[model samples]
Target: MIRDIDVVVIGGGQAGLAAGYHLRRRGLDFVVLDAQASPGGAWQQAWDSLNLFSPAAYSSLPGRVMPGQPGETYPDARHVVDYLTDYEQRYDLPVVRPVRVEAVHPDGDRLRVGTDTGIWRARAVISATGTWWRPFLPAVPGRTAFGGAQLHTVGYRRPADLAGQKVVVVGGGNSGAQIAADLVHATDLTWVTQRPTRFLADSVDGRALFDHATARRRALDEGSADTGGVASLGDIVVVPPVREARDAGLLKAQPMFRRLTATGVEWADGTRAEADTIIWCTGFRPALSHLAPLGLRGPRGHIPTAGTQALEEPRLHLLGYGDWTGPASATLIGVGRPARDAATAIVELLSLP
Candidate 1:
């Protein structure tokens, strides 16, 4: 049966849930389709020790707040998963699980969303598919010939996996720092970044970073003349564990290696270090392959969006990909405003008389 809907949100992550919240508030009929059998989006796949840089108060979606457990400052992956599950049940959002969306194509004035289960015709489509599924690995010379075990951040789960092994953690981002911090106690670890890593002050956390970003975004939006330095979310927040690791002389990161050797990595000065495992925390690209049939993606594999609405396809709205789609749209705290705007836009488009 070809089901019809006012809107079809192509994810059940934080962004999708927020969009569903606003859509429900607007009294619009919508369905959120999730690829995962369970909730929590990509958080379900994060490392066991992974915790949000932000406190629970700052890491929440729309409507309800993320309640922190007693004495727990930052919520971990499992906490987030439980919150997401509860959020869905609380709002009663129409989310179909384990339904993989294969493609979205134009069908007259509507979009035909082809899924593994069945086809759905929607007046508007909101693509909230986050970037976790697409892990990026840099192209280093001799990478293919390396005999050591190599894994991306997506494949990493715990430190015990590389216990007693000489491990190399690559990338300068928060994930790289945190993972290296966690693995340093479990293994002999080396950290590699393209440049020197910048660690934020111990007092500064994800909440503070979000505030700074929000202020910067507001200034830009309001056409203000502020040219002061604005801290980005990419700046490593010295979380308790990471700070402890640094205090213990374990958070050192070296410049990127020149190339990978058969046994390990080689530096520009011809220095070679033997390693048993390499963890690449290079990051991820947006999961937009399902929208390829629409031919909306540009050379950079991104859809040109005007405040979350696709410039190429008006009925298609993209959410939670990153700053291009919306300011801080990829984070839990950042996704709500954009999701609300997206839902409002979808409703306005569908309500056209």
Candidate 2:
């Protein structure tokens, strides 16, 4: 059966939830389509030891704040999952789950969202599909021939899987560092990165970094120079666990390997290291495959957007894909504003005569 709505939100993660809040406020006839069987979105797939870099108070979606457990400074993945599930129920948002979106096509004056279960015809579409599904593995030589087990950060669950083996954790991002630290307890681990990983000061956390980014963005918008010495949020925050690992001398990182050998990896300096497994903490690309039918994606595989509205397809808006969609839209705290704006814009567009 074909369902008609004023707006269709694809992907019911933090971004989608934020959008849902605003859409509900406007009393729009919208529905959120989530591919996951349950709630929590990408948080369900994060590593077992993964924790938010910010405190619970600072990490939240629109309307409601995430409640943190007593004595817990940072919330873990499971906590986030539970919070998201609760948030969905609290708002009574119209969400249809486990229905994977197949494609989004322009249908004359409206957009047609094709899913595995049915079709949703809407005047506007919001693509909030974040980057968790599309794990990007760099094109390393001999990668296909590697004999050892190789897994991306998404596939990683626990450290016991690599117990008593030589493991190489690639990428200098927070995931790479955290995974390598966790694996050090159960395996001989090596950290590899394309460039040196910068660690934020111990006093700084995800909240501070987010605030700095917000300030910078505001400064840019106001046409003023930002004099703050703050760096990008991509820099690793010295979370307690990571700090402990570093203090224990288990956080040293090596330059990236030249290529993967059948048995292990080869360094650029003619050095070879044998490994039983390789854990790639390399980042992710946008999960925008369903939008392929639109033919609006640029060379970087992202649809150009002006504050959440798609440049080519104005009826479509994108959220939580990263800064390209909106400043800090990928973060829980940052997704709210853009989502609200997108909701308002959709309402205005649909009301046009």
Candidate 3:
């Protein structure tokens, strides 16, 4: 027999935790199912040295304040995980751990979710698995045949992991930059990027740099003469690439690789850079395999959610899915409203005759 509930949240990450918090506060009957043994999802897997660019000021989740010194710098990945674990304990959130949900299907005014543990039936489901489910690995011919050590940015922890090895860090995003900078001290590093990203220093009027997104939003609402376009995080936060490398004589910037061979990376312009290891920092994708039949997914695999690109489905919602818009819709600070609203919607759905 399948266990039944009002709602079954399909993840237990930050987004999922936020969702659960609101659900509990609203006195709703729900269960959170997660594959991981604990909360804090991808955060727990982050590199030890990794710290959020956003300071503790704007990083708190709903209700619980992130414990730290005021005007202090951003917290590391471990701090984030610890905070989330504390949130779970404080709320007594009904989260069932180590349960991998395999599939979900609509079933007669309800939904049936299949997991390794058991079957679960719910009137509504919040699929808050997040956008980092699948790692984006570029399709390069002869990639699999390469005999060198290759890793995705998700698995990369620190420079010591690649000490003394000639490493080729792929992609131009924030993660790629940080990894390259960290490894420079311990290895022969080549930062192979598709294109040089336009960078900005992380500060404003000599104040502790806040998210440029916050500034842009205020500019629009105030109707000031200058409603500047979406500003990049590069404008406010100090990116590792700019702070450490490019400034120091540590890393060599190279063009993106056109092809891959057993020996090293081959650039589009017929240039070759030999590397002992290749780290793909190409980013991630949304995992919506279970959402296949929803038919709400856009041109890309992303779903067009209502609150935060939440779906039209009454109780279904998504937080932090990407768009060309300004900053991440799914940031820890931004997720509260959507989670609250989603909980409200779920409660209303349950209360109906």
- How many residue pairs clash in all the candidates, one count each? 0, 0, 6
User: Model 2 Cα RMSD, Å?
Assistant: 1.5
lDDT at 267, model 2: 92
Q: What is the lDDT of candidate 2?
A: 0.90
lDDT of 1 at 29: 83
- Candidate RMSDs in Å, in order, are 1.5, 1.5, 3.6
**Candidate 2, superposed: residue stretches over 4 Å from native:** 225-234
What TM-score would candidate 3 get against the native? Answer: 0.87
Q: Per-residue lDDT for 138-217 in model 2, tens only? A: 99999998998999999999988779999999988888888888888899888999998898888888778767767777
Alpha carbon lDDT at 252, candidate 2: 94
Summarize candidate 3's per-residue lDDT along 1-353 as a digit string, tens digits.
59988889888888788889998998878999888987788898997677776666578779988887444376778888988899888999988999998887777888788889899889888887776778889888779877798999888987777889988888776677777777888898888887765455545311223244556555665786543433443422355444776677665567777788888878768888788999998988887777776666676677665554345566565654542221344567766666787788778778899
- Model 2's TM-score against the true structure: 0.97
Q: Candidates' TM-scores?
A: 0.97, 0.97, 0.87
Query: Could you tell me the TM-score of candidate 1?
Result: 0.97
Q: Compute the lDDT of residue 100 as modeled in candidate 2.
A: 96
